[model samples]
Structure formats: structure tokens, C-alpha cells
Target: MATLLHIDSSVFPGETSSSRSVTDAFRKAWGEQHPEGRVIYRDLAADPVPHITATAHLAGLAPASERTPEQSAALAARVELIEELEQADAVLIGAPMYNYSIPSTLKTWLDNVILAGRTSGETPSAQGTPVVVVASRGGSYAPGTPREGFEFVQNYLEAVLKGSLGLEPEFIVPELTMAPRVPAMSELVPLYHASRERAFVEAATKAKDLAERLAV
Candidate 1:
């Protein structure tokens, strides 16, 4: 059975978060399709990732014997994270578009887990299993609408994952805002926010369905 890696980076829990809820839907669908498959969840909210520093960064390429004690220890934790990502057959990401971009926490984790050499480095082509990126945005960012800014998050993510990490990203699907918002939407502003969240669920359902069929 395939081993799926579910990474959730949203600060809000349950229905409060558009991104997390959408990701949860994908996970649920995946679970239904592959009951026996293992799903390893990494919650960046509860267990925050460790920050990378200059010494720690250099230590990753150094031979074990040549590294300082602190550098070696720090590198160990980071290497393990990369290993976990590489081992997974599939991956699901929950990202919320903040200021027309991805969250900072997700970027931090990406910087750490997506390493060179082991993941890409010598690899001739961008080779790896594709992961789904599901996001929710308050403002409308559809193809032809106004305020449709192409943020660097999706573009940068695809490049790095495909080039450096050797991890192929399947899609950059963002459920965005539009006309009438959603139910339980208190004020107009809140409703606008909630609508974006609802779109996340809708988009995630489609991505999950596609993935399940492909996996089978």
C-alpha cells in the first residue's frame, strides 16, 4: 500500500481554517480509497519547525567526523525530515494564500525538508511523486478577474520541488472568493472570508478524487 504524507500548516483548526479543512477533505477521501495505506501526518502548527542557521546549513554537507557537535546534531534532525518526505508515496499540502502568497511556516518547512543531493542534486530530470497543493484565498484570483496577481508561491514552489527536491507538485489549486460568500458568514467581510474557505473544500474534493483514481 502507498504511504501518504499529510502536511498541515494552518494556524486555525476545524472549520475555522479554509486550507486545513480542504486538506482534511482530501485526506478523508484518500483514506476511503486506500483503507490500508499508511498516512503520516505532520502538523506544523502544534509542533513548530526548528529554524535553520548558518552553522547548521553548512554542517549538512560536511562529513560526520568533520562537523562540530552542535552542527551535527542539528543536521541530524533536518536530514531525518528529508528522509521522511522522500519515503512517502504521496503528499498532501494545506496552504492558505496570505497577501496573495503562501504561509511563512510552510515555507520554512519546505526550505528544510526539500534538500539537495539526496532529493535532487545529481538527478538529471525532475523526478519524484507529485504532491497536491490545496489553498484558500479571501480575494478572487481566478484567471480573468481583477486583483489576479500571480504570486511567486506557486511558481517558486513548483520550480524548487521539481528542480532541487525532485518532488513533482501535481497542482496549485486555490479555492478563491467571488460573488455571494457562504453560510454561517456573519458580516459581509466575514462572509467574504468564509466563501473563500468553502471554495477550498470544493477544490480539495476534486483534487482528492483525481488522486485516488490515479493511485488506484
Candidate 2:
């Protein structure tokens, strides 16, 4: 059976987190479509990955056989993470915008998985592995908005995962997530709920389609 790696980076729990709720929908659809398929879940907010340190950075660059004990220990967790990604047939990520960028916990996981030789280096291409990202933002960042260019989450992820890592990713974004809760955004509540609904629907559809297509 095919395997999927599900990663959630939201700090909030339950329905309070748009990204998590959307990803949960995706997971539900995926499970229904591929009941026998394997799923590996990692909750970065609850259990954050270690940030890449200078030593770990150097360790990843060197040949595994040549690393020292310290380097080997430092690189172990990262190696495991990369192995999980490489082994999976597909990936799903719950990515929420924080301070105009991805969560630091998610960033740390990316740093761990974007390894040379293991994930991207010398591979034919990474595009064959599909990735679905459920991205949610507190405010709207679409074109023509005041914060149009300020949004960096999607662009940065695309650049790293697709441009650099060669993986093909599809993004489902829910904007104005804070509208329902923030008095300043009360006028945008309708749009917020609409966006939220669309995100879950899109995620479920994509998950089912991908599972069917990728399942062996």
C-alpha cells in the first residue's frame, strides 16, 4: 500500500486552527479512499524538530561515513525525517501563516527534510512526489490588498519545495481566518467563513483524488 506523510504545524488545537481543521479533512478523505494505506503523522507544534545548527549543517554536507560521533548524533533525527519523506508516496502539510511567513516549527521541519543526496541531490526529479499544502492566513494577502506582496508563506514554500527541492506542490489557502474573532475584521466575517469552507472542500477533494491516483 502507498504511504502518506501528514505534517501539521498549527499551534492551536481543534477548530480554532484553520490549517489543522483543513488538514484533518484531507486526512479523513485520504483515509476513506485508501483505508489500507499507511500514514505517518508529525505534529510540529506539539513536538518541534530541532533547528539546524552549524554542526548539523556541516554534518549533512559531509559524507555519512566521514562524520564524527557528534555529527552523526546531530544528523540522526534529520536523517530519519528525510527518510520518512523519501519513503512516502505523497505528503500533506498544514501550513499556517505567522508574522507573514511559515511557522518556525514548520520551518525547522523543512530544514531537516530539504537534505542533499537523500531528498533532492542527484535525483531525477522531485516533481513525481505530490505534496498538498493547506495554508491559512489570519488576513487576506491576495493581489490588490495592502499586504499583497507582504505574504511570503506560499511563495517561499514553492521556491524551496518546488524550485529548489524539485517537488510539485498544490496549495489550498484560506484567507481572513481572524475575521470572525477580531472586531476590526467583523465586516469580513462572511468572506472568512466562505474561504474556510472552500479550504476544507478543496482539501478533501484533492486528498481523495490524489489517494486514488497514487494508490497502487
Q: Which stretches of candidate 1 lie over 4 Å from their true place?
A: 124-126, 172-174, 177-216
lDDT by residue (1-216, candidate 1, tens digit) is 877888888788877776777687777777877789888888888786887777768887787789999988888888777777877777888877777677778888877775556566886222576678776666556668676666556676778777677776765454443223554323456556456555555655755665666577
What digit string (tens of lDDT, one per residue) describes model 2 on residues 1-216?
A: 889899999999978899999999999999888889899999999999999998888898998799999999989978888878878889999999999999999999988778776666667234468999988999999989999999899999998888767788999999999998899999999999899889988998998889778755
* Per-model TM values vs. the true structure: 0.80, 0.95
- Report lDDT per candidate: 0.70, 0.88
Residue-level error in angstroms, candidate 1, position 7 = 0.7
Worst 10 residues of 2 by lDDT: 118-127
**How high is the lDDT of residue 163 in model 2?**
70
RMSD of each: 4.1, 1.5
Q: lDDT (0-100) at residue 66 of candidate 1?
A: 94
Identify the runs in model 2 with alpha carbons over 4 angstroms from their true place: 122-127
Clashing pairs in 2: none
- Please report the candidate that would top TM-score against the real structure: 2
